[model samples]
Target chain A: MTDLIERPSTEAVPGHGAPTHGDDDHAHGGDHEHHGPSGILKWLTSTDHKVIGINYTVTSIVMMVIGGAFAEVIRAQLVSPTNTLVTFQQYNQLFTMHGSVMIYLFVGPFAFAGLANYLVPLQVGAPDMAFPRLNALSYWLYLSGSITMLLGFFVTGGPAAFGWVGYAPLTSAINAPGAGPDLWIGALMLTGFSAIFSGVNLIATIFYLRAPGMTLFRMPIFTWNMLVTGILILLAFPVLTAGLVMLYCDRHFGTHIFEVQGGGVPLLWQHIFWFWGHPEVYILALPFFGMVTEVIPTFSRKPLFGYKGMVFATLTIAALSLGVWAHHMFTTGAVLLPFFSIMSLLIAVPTGIKIFNWIGTMWGGNLVFSTAMLMAIGFVVTFLIGGITGIYLASPPLDFFTHDTYFVIAHFHSVVMALTLGAFAGIYFWFPKITGKMLHEGWGKAQFWLLFIGTQVFTVPLYIVGLHGMPRRMAVYPNNPSWQNLNEWSSVGALMIGISTLLFVVNVIQAYRKPIPAGDNPWDASTLEWFTSSPPPHHNFVSLPPIRSERPVWDYNHPDAPALAHGHHETATPPAAPAEQEAHA
Target chain B: MKQESVILLLLGVFFGFIGVVYWGWGHEDGGGIMLLGAFLLGMLPGFYYLWWYRKSGGNRPEDRDDATVADGAGVVDAFPSTSIWPFVLGSGCFFIVLALTFGTWLLVPGVGLLLSALIGATAESRRGGNV
Candidate 1:
């Protein structure tokens, strides 16, 4: 193992030229295996971070559709006050599985692991992750876990129906008998391992693999977010892993950890789960914050406003997120309500600082409302609304009324929905760089509008009905008749979101079929990623510009007015000749 | 990095002050403990970064604006070419989890696969095999 760690193999310098190292028999010193491996095996055994990233993205999309299908069934059942669409058992399974798949499989993995895997290495100007083999292992573990979780649907008693939270006593063996919840527990444990592995890999890569000139302060905002996210995952995931193990032991080994009759405390599960759960919320959303941070600066054609403030705000949010987890347990009566309430409210301050920084970034710049920028701006608006609504819930007195109601549903859904928008914005902005193909702007805009308008239409009524005393997760509601209209309106909104998602699928397909090459730096952005080729080669870059500031390319473009000049270590080597400059350009 | 550390340290102090105020006001149960936790957590990264900044002479490559892509050209970073251990490890985990439902007997192979996968992933590159 030490020998493997110390192996002196040839490294490939891609993008500039072909294999220059003559010692190795393998093409590109085995680093460029993506060029060699073909067909399905390439995808399965390939250790390439890019391939694993693509695999994660595709799988998460499919999971999103499956989760969305479950959601549609939920909406269909709730279209009217009567329970005509499905029985209570089936409805319970639908909502539970929907929430589980969307949170664990789709949103969290897609944003943190999937997108981060692809972009982080590129953004940091590294050939691959610090641990490529471990990267592959993480992806495979995620797939295995996702598959295991989904397999519960085929079980005799159906999938776990104890809510996505999987609160205990309810999820204990005596109460929820079957392989369904067991599979859920097992799946969560596996995915928990996957997340921890990815977290370690990302933190290592970002910390150690940065280019020579890319300092900690100069790292991209997206990379900063990923860094903090990696820390949060490392800190928080173990609690969930422990919780899953305890639950598994309770279910299979009869340890009765949550069995109140057996001297167990059900609230223990809540404490453990929410300890990870609230951070998991930020885990899912912080990447989007990073995405918006990138998009706003690029389209606004300005360096990020309060760059130092944004970084500190992100770190602050991460730290505060840990202490505020009990906010979710505000109504449980077992929690210290005042402590949780104040912490929850205080966490909002750093988040508000971030929003202000974003708006300040766009305040006095050439703001271009491209599809990506529009989605990002949309994220800012919707996420702010979500954040504000959250503050209302932070008050324990207010939470008492809103707990388990559609109001609670409205708050989180708004945040996650905004996250979805930000994810879409990131996809649009980076699609050109990833695939070297630009999506059709008209179709992209159409899809965005449909989603934006539809999301509002869908969630606004939910808030209204919730305020009107409608409870969530109900298979059927009372024949209040007035609640029926709002529910139906929300159902219509769900349909629009569905249609818009399909349009997005079509847009991706259509764009891929007719490829238009997006030149390097199509957006002329300032980040290191823009300095490389669109659809960068195996090793990502041939040569990187001297990173003197956060935006190296910006400095390259404006040599006279460089962003920062102090502390730059100028090598004795002469500047590039005019001809060389032209060639590089 | 120093600037960020200072800002975070200040924020930590502010939150700590809030905790003290809350405690004084007799809302100390959840509020004071949580606020204090937040303050301590905040100070952790702040001090860590401050240490790093001092240790590294406060110089960062990202702080240089005169660099170009050509300056970055060199031997690319090393990466493993191909390996089957990740697959083995994933399958091992899947089976181990699956064994919870089917039978405990599958755990033997699961453990075997896991151990072997770990060995393979760690030692493959040593033999000049795929990375």
Candidate 2:
């Protein structure tokens, strides 16, 4: 690696001669890596981060559709008291697959593997990830894991139906006794290993590959969130892998780590699972939080408020999250209840700080209500509700009462809603940069409203019925008009949610079909990504803008902006050299 | 070495402090040991970055306040061309997974593909061509 870098393989463009950075010895960017095979072979064998990112993303979208299909079927079964849309056994499999596919394959990978793979190197001005081939391997491994999981349905006894948690002796060989649960375990182990490697790749990129003058603090908030997310993945995934290994041994190798008959403790499973599970929540969230941070500043036409505070707050939230896993186990009675509860409640402090930071960025600014911006606003509102409910659930008494009820379902769904909206905002915001084509703004808004309203319609009744003592994972129920009516409304909302995703599918197709080319910097965004060409060239940059502050692109464009005018650089302490000043001017 | 180490150190301290407290009070050695393991996990990486920072003398262009953008410009590493090693590795992992569903006899080919992929990838990286 050092030999290749020190070799200085500089190549020149034919006619486009721009000032290529400071030293003439430097290699030109964006002039290499156009050689290789084409078509499907290219996609499978390519080492390009952007191609791998698109692979991760497109595959995740398909998985989401699959998970959502499971959801729709499950909802149809629950829509009426006497409905037999699916057998109880089928319902078990449906919800099981739904939760597994959505959490593992869809949300977490969409951010950690998909968007991060595409954006990190571009935003950092690096030629590629620190380990390009390893990056390719991570994507393929992820695909294999996804395929293994989906193949469970075709196995002899149907897919694993012990819920996504795959809790305890219920998942042991004595009970499950088939290849389905074993396949699920194997699939999860593969995915978990894939995530661990991705963490190594991303963290190395951020640490070793920043452009000149882009200090750790000068890196954008999106990259910062990704950095923290990378660490959490490293810290959390290995434990999950360990637990899965123990369970796999119990099932296949006759080890009795989780079998009650062998004097194994079942609660140990909860301890191991939630240890990874709680941190997994932040793994899914922090990247979307990064998205919201990016979008609000761009559309509000202001800098992110408390940039340093947001960074520290992200760290604080992660550290607190690692200690709060027992909050999920308060109903189980085998945890240090007070310690975990207090730690769980303490996460609210940093999260609340983040909320205020978004609102502060939008306050008194020229806020543009674009589809992306509207989604950011929507994220703030919905995520706040999720946060409040989370606080309620942190208390042992409340959590004990709401442990398996729709109330807990409503709370988490609100959070998923917020992050999904945040992801939608990121997609619309960066679609231009990814494909060099503008998504239809009208259709984008149409989809956003459908999703937002659908979430409320679906979850509000869930909270109401949960308060009225409705439980979750109940495939059949006695006829009661009130619960029946509320569930019907929720079912309608589920249909609306399904329609919205389909609309998004249509919007993506139309955008590609009748292409409206979006010029670079369509939103006049502050981040480094906006400084590059749309659907950036293979190596991602021609020449990077001079980095003097967190908002390097903004500093380069608005030379007289107050932030730069007052000399607010995070990296350099000395006054700018004359040529440097002249160049920036 | 850098601010990241400091961040990791802070996490380690938080986990380590709670770990001692939990063991002192809770009396169940299992959970406390897990907390200690977490502390060690955070600290090991923290110390590694710190070590690299010191060994490199902490004079990286990124750390230089007055460094020009071009000082950091260049191809950071050689991005290799297309190869089938990742695909080979994937198939190896897939077969290992399948070995669980089918009989244990499949482990032979599964482990075989995995070892071949490892050796093949190492050779491919050191030399040129598919090997």
Candidate 3:
């Protein structure tokens, strides 16, 4: 294993004219393996991060479709009062699967693992991830975990319908007696391990594998955010792992951890799960935060404002995220109010700072409202609403009123849905770089607006419905006069969101059908990734261009201080690197 | 003290720290935390070697393929031709996932895909074809 990288081997440098040395072997970014699929075996044995990224993406998309279909079923069931398009069992399963897939299986993994798989090494100027084989293992584990979950749908009694949270007493052996909850527990455990492994690999890579002269301050904001996110995962995932193990023991081995009659505390499950769970909210949102940070600067044609502050803010969020886990449990009545409220409210500070930084980044620059920017900007709006609403939820007084009401659903779904949209904006923005094929812009914008309007139309009304006393996750409600109009409007919004997603699928398929050229730097972004070829070569860099700032590629392109060295040595600080001057200026 | 070995060792150490923190401090159930921490101690060299590589030298393109050799010495060839193992592993992944998602019929194909890819790709790599 030491020989894998410790001992150097002889080979001719591909593009560069120089004869290489042992140190260069580890540094040279090139294909150590097949770049694209050549044969059946190559496809299977592939360890390439890019290939794995695509796989994560494709799998998540399929899951998205399945999840969306479930949402559609939910909507269809609620189109009118007392309508039973599906049985209650089916309804429960549908919502359970929908939430589970969207959060655990689809969104977080797709963004973190998928985006990190594709970009993290590139951003940090590494040839590949620190642990490439482990990277492959993470993907495999995730697939298996997802499979274990989907298999429960085919079970005799049906899948776990206790909701994605799997709150106990409900999920305990007695209330939901079956293999259904077992599958959910087991499958999620598998996925959880996969996430932890990927997080560790990514963190190690960023920490250890940076190119020469790429200091911590010189790293891109996206990379910085990922680094913090990685730490959060390291801290957050193990607890979830412990919680799941306990849950599994409780369900299968007759352990009375959450069994109320057996001297178990039901709230313990909430505490344990939310320990991992609340950070997960940021785990999901922070990547989107990174995405918007990348988008606003690139499209606005300005250096990201408050670069160091942004990094600090991101880290602050990760740190503060741990304290706020109890916010999710306020409605349970078991939470310690002042402690939970303070933690929750403190979260708003960093979050608010991030939004300010983003707006500041876009204040005055050559704003190119590309489809990516549009979605990013949209994320700013939607997330602000989500965050503002989050403030209300933080107060125990307000939460008491909103608890289990449509308002809580409205608040959370806005964050989840909008953050996802932000991620999609990032995907569409970077899709070209990853695929070396341009995604259709018109269609991309089309998908964005449809989703944007759809989410607003659907989620906003839920607030009114909640205030009117409509409970969430419930299939049937009496058609009270005030509730009548809001539910209909909400259903209408759900359809729009659905249609928008359909458009997105169509756009992705069409973009793939006809490849369009996305040159090495489509957005002219300053990050290290833009320095490489679109669909970067198997080994990412032939030359680690003299990096004076985090945006080494940007320096390379600028005429006055063009990137100096294109080989193994780091370039000395240039006369006036924009990253340095702009950061200070 | 090649950078690569140092990195591997360093990784082992970091994992050890994580093991202690997560297993030891983080959990109330400390049953396996110590053992897991001990196991993580094994990954130290890998981390150390990785660190050494980044620290010991500058980025010289001329030395890019020299990774398999000792720093500034030896004739070990590091830049072996592209291995297909990861791809095969991924395909095996596809099949396994397929089998899980679709059913047992898919399992046969999945296993076939996984086995053939792993065996063929790995066997060939060990035979020194890419190098």
Q: What DockQ results do all the predictions give, each relative to the true complex?
A: 0.28, 0.47, 0.11
Which residue runs of candidate 2 sit more than 4 Å off their true CA positions?
A1-33, A564-585, B128-131
Task: Report the lDDT tens digits of candidate 2 across residue range A1-585.
Answer: 112332122222312333243233343643443557799888877777889889999998899999999989988999998788888878898989999999999999999989999998888877677777788788878898899898988988898988998899789887887888988988898889889888988998898888777788888888999999999998899989999999999988888888888888888888889889999999999999998899998877777888888998999998888888878888877788888888899999999999999998888677667788888888899899889999999999989888999999889989998888898998988888898888887888899899989988988898888888888999987799999999999988889999999999999999889887876767767788777777776667656666777887766666556564222222212222223112212
DockQ of 2: 0.47
lDDT of 3 by residue, A434-550 (tens): 877777778878888888888898889888889887888888889776676787888888898888888887877887887667767777677878766777766465444555665
The weakest ten consecutive residues by lDDT in model 2 chain A span A572-581
Q: List per-prediction Cα lDDT, in the order shown.
A: 0.79, 0.82, 0.70
- Residues B25-98, candidate 2, lDDT per residue (tens digit)? 76756667777888997898899988988887866777666667657655466566566677778778888888
Q: Rank by TM-score, highest first.
A: 2, 1, 3
lDDT per residue as tens, model 1, A269-323: 8878887898899999899999889888887776788887888888888877776
**Model 1 backbone overlap count:** 21
Candidate 1 error regions (>4 Å): A1-34, A560-585, B1-77, B128-131
Which prediction has more favorable lDDT, 1 or 3?
A: 1
Q: Where is model 3 more than 4 Å wrong at Cα?
A: A1-39, A561-585, B1-131
- Residue A521 of model 1 has an lDDT of 62
> Using TM-score as the measure, which candidate wins?
2
Best candidate (score: lDDT): 2
> What are the models' TM-scores?
0.87, 0.93, 0.80
